[model samples]
Target: MPRTDKASRLIAAPPARVYAAFVDPDELLAWLPPGDMTGRFDHFDARTGGSYRLTLTYPDAGTGKTTTDSDVVEARFVEVVPGVRVVQAVDFVSDDPAYAGTMIMTWAVAAAESGTRVEIRADNVPDGISAEDHAVGLASSLANLAAHVEN
Candidate 1:
């Protein structure tokens, strides 16, 4: 069976602002990367069936892990609903056979009492990615988002 990762957080921002953080390339760069990583998008189109390429780079070496300079992702939007949801088809650019297939990442945004409830679900995860690491990465990204939007 394929592996999946799910993470959720209550962001201290409205649904529209939280949703905008995902689709806006500039906002994405501010919050998408986890921990000591940074992100840059080649180009972004915020519509159904639109595609984008992003590069994530790690700048620090203290994590005790030998890592690549960058990880690239080529993704397309499968579904897009303003302030509500986004479903993406993502493929990592890697030579490893285990990471060759396409995975689905869904972002569900809902209106909560004071802010927005954001949930992320990643399905068909590549075997090359460690589940524990991915969980940390997901949680980290959410925390980054909260920090970006709440301040």
Candidate 2:
């Protein structure tokens, strides 16, 4: 069976700013990686039908899906609504069958009383990623995002 993971945060920024952080490569590079991972994009295009390839390098050895310390992800922009939402179809570039599948990642931002409410929903998550780990990763990413946009 497929699994879904979700995380949300209230950022002290406007919706447009929060949304831009999601689409901009520089902003994404600053906050997308969770925990001790660092990220760089091989190519990026933020639009419907566009695509991007991102490589995330983990701090620890032998903890990556693609390489010994790296995880490569190829994602296509399935939907892009400015200031509202962005939906991506993501694939992990790995030889292991446990991580070979397309996952849908939906990022939604909405105006709130204090700030923008950002939510991320990941569907059809690969079985190789445990739920607890994914939850921590998602929360970490959200916290990073909040820090990036709030400051």
Highest TM-score model number: 2
lDDT of 1 at 99: 78
lDDT of 1 by residue, 34-92 (tens): 98898888989979999999888888543322246778899999999887999999998
Of the candidates shown, which would achieve the greatest lDDT relative to the real structure? 2
Looking at model 2, the pairs that clash are none
lDDT of 2 by residue, 70-128 (tens): 99999999999998999999999999999989999999999999999999999999999
Q: Model 2 Cα RMSD, Å?
A: 0.6
> Model 1, 74: alpha-carbon shift in Å?
0.3
| After superposition, candidate 1 runs with Cα above 4 Å error | 60-67
User: What is the lDDT for 79 in model 1?
Assistant: 99
Clashing pairs in 1: none
RMSD of each: 2.4, 0.6
